[model samples]
Target: KYQRAATCLTKDREALLAFYDFPADHWDHLRTSNPIESVFVTVRHRTVRTKGALSQKTARLMVYKLVQAAAKGWRRLKGANQLPMVTEGVKFTDGVIDAKNRAA
Candidate 1:
C-alpha cells in the first residue's frame, strides 16, 4: 500500500517529488522529517491570521515562543523507555557517535 501511494505521488505531485533530492539517504527518515516541517507551516498559518502583514519582530517572536513551548514536552519522552539504537546498511555504525572510529 505504501509503495503504491509513493508511486502515485512520484508521478503526480511535482512539489512532493522535489523533496527526493538524494534518494539514497534514508527515505524513511526523510518521510519522518515532513512532520517537523509542519511546525513551520503552523507558524505561517498563525502569522497570516493577523489583520495586516506582520512586523518582522512580531513574526519572529511568535515563531520563537511557539517553537519553545512545543519543545517543552518533546525531550521528556525521547529518553524515557528508550530502546537500543538500530542501524542499517551502509549506516551500520552501531550507535557510535563518532562514525570515523567505528569498525565500518
Candidate 2:
C-alpha cells in the first residue's frame, strides 16, 4: 500500500506541487473547488423561488445580474496586492516569493 501510494504521488507530483505555487495568504481560496459557492447560495435560492415560471433566457439574465450585484459586496482577496508580481512570473515557495526571485 505504501509503495502504491508513493507511486501515485510521484506520478501526480506536478499537480501536488501547484498548491504551493500560490502565496500562503490565498491558499484558502485555491485549495477549494469554489470558494464563492456559499455566496451563490442566496442567488440559487432566489432563482428557485421563481418556481421555473420564467423563461430560460430571463432566468439566466436574472442570475447574471444577481451575481454582478453580489460581486460589489465581496471582499478582496488576501494578498491581492501581490497578484501582479505572481502574474509577472514571480516564483513563490510556500506562499511567499523566494528571496532569490524577488526584484532588487
Worst 10 residues of 2 by lDDT: 30-39
Candidate 2 local lDDT, 24-74, one digit each (tens): 988877777563885588688888888874588898888888898888877
TM-score for predicted model 2 compared with the true structure: 0.76
Error of 1 at 76 (Å): 5.8
User: In order, what lDDT does every prediction score?
Assistant: 0.53, 0.83
Per-residue alpha-carbon lDDT of candidate 1 for residues 1-104, written as tens digits (9 for 90 to 100): 59998898878886665444323233445457655776777767776786544588886788898777666644332322212322232222222223642454
Once fitted onto the true fold, the runs of candidate 2 whose alpha carbons sit more than 4 angstroms away are none
**Best candidate per lDDT, number?**
2
Candidate 1 clashes between residue pairs 3 or more apart in a chain or in different chains:
none
- The per-residue C-alpha lDDT of model 2 at residue 43 equals 86
Instruction: Give the C-alpha lDDT of model 1.
Output: 0.53
